[model samples]
Target: MPGRNDEDNKPVAVTTSLFMHPASSPHAKTVFWGMLATRPDRRGEKIALLLGAQAIVHMWEKEGARGFMTGVRQDNASSAALCNRLGISDTDWTYSVCIDPEMLGRKNLTK
Candidate 1:
């Protein structure tokens, strides 16, 4: 969580993660920065950068994390820019397919 005032301890920006990915190599330490968000009002204020840096420091110092990875949606330009600013390269692309639960039970779900 990252914020400017104690009164707003509820975090303007937040980063959360698991210490390791299930698919990660056992011989090395890894951390997955699973989620990141900054309040709509706080966007472009570097709150996300502050929180992200704090998370990385905590992982390296407290958890001995040697590898870090995260996923950002391709359409999220701000997030992609943040990643670029942080020196993280876009190494791969991931594709996802989703279906509405209501449509799951429908017979003609060709859409």
Candidate 2:
């Protein structure tokens, strides 16, 4: 799948709100590298690299970012490698999401 369509033109990838760190946090100016996944057949084309670099650079210039960071699962070697290739470093920090296991796949609307 080339994942390109002049017909529908829907977005294939999304950048999420996880990148929005709190202003009060010490790492406020740090840019979170939001990674995009290409189709399995499209891997190694460095498409992720191009998009990531653009997003990172835009944030750096627009927000005056002091550093860049991202959250990748410890088991995700590919993502970690991309992070490194983009000139970002991994931290000892752990990212956790608190949600009830039973609530998964259900509409848990919480403000």
Candidate 3:
């Protein structure tokens, strides 16, 4: 669903992409929902809420996802609020990310 073009002739649109994937951990029943975002121009419209809920249900029913989880940055109030509205509660889970320095053209340092 492409929207109006910007001043630079680039197409701008409101897109919600569901990134639910199987958890790589030993817990096979968990699904990791990643990167749920909505443009500020379309906030307060319950778009994120609807999309997330629908995706969760589909994953649970059709994909055998027993648990759904996502991480929100501590400073992102809007995302936190949206998650709460979608009946998602905070848990004891901690989200961690690691990137290899070589991926960015740097060698790993060993002390």
Candidate 4:
């Protein structure tokens, strides 16, 4: 992850992680990006766009990747906006389940 620091030398924004993985298609070589996050305060500052462009360049130029893929939760309007700004195509829907560590051994869980 790369970031820009404030004048006080404290990091204000960062691209937390950019993971590259092989796509499922066997006909062509492709890459998929994983997580990308920034500090809550810096959400609207275009840091994610810059980092995403850098990641794309790295993948295409350095790693010889053919294409990119990533997913954003439907409820995350911010991420969806960013994807639109980046010209990423809206592809498919995905579902996820989260488990709480404290509820691991419990028979019944309460919200």
Residues 56-110, model 1: lDDT tens digits: 7777788787777777766777777776776666765453547696966654311
Off by more than 4 A, model 2: 1-19, 99-111
Please list the Cα RMSD from the true structure of every candidate, rounded to 1 decimal place. Answer: 7.3, 6.5, 8.2, 6.6
Please name the candidate that would achieve the greatest lDDT relative to the true structure: 1
Consecutive 10-residue window with the lowest summed lDDT within model 2: 10-19
Best by TM-score: 1
lDDT of 4 by residue, 1-111 (tens): 366777888776544333333355462455555356666666667777888777777767876766566667667777777767766668663435487868776542110
**lDDT of every predicted structure (CA atoms):** 0.64, 0.61, 0.60, 0.61
C-alpha RMSD of candidate 2:
6.5
Residue-level lDDT tens digits of model 3 in 14-110: 3232334435756667776635545555556666666677677777787777776777777777777777876677999886867677775563211
Q: What global local distance difference test value does model 1 have?
A: 0.64
Per-candidate TM-score against the hidden true structure? 0.67, 0.66, 0.62, 0.62
Candidate 3, which ten residues in sequence have the lowest lDDT sum? 12-21
What is the TM-score of candidate 2? 0.66
Clashes of each: 0, 0, 0, 0
Candidate 2, residue 27: the lDDT equals 77
Question: Where's the lowest-lDDT run of ten residues in candidate 4?
Answer: 14-23
Candidate 4: give the clashing pairs.
none
Please estimate how well model 4 matches the true structure, expressed as its whole-model Cα lDDT. 0.61
TM-score of 3: 0.62
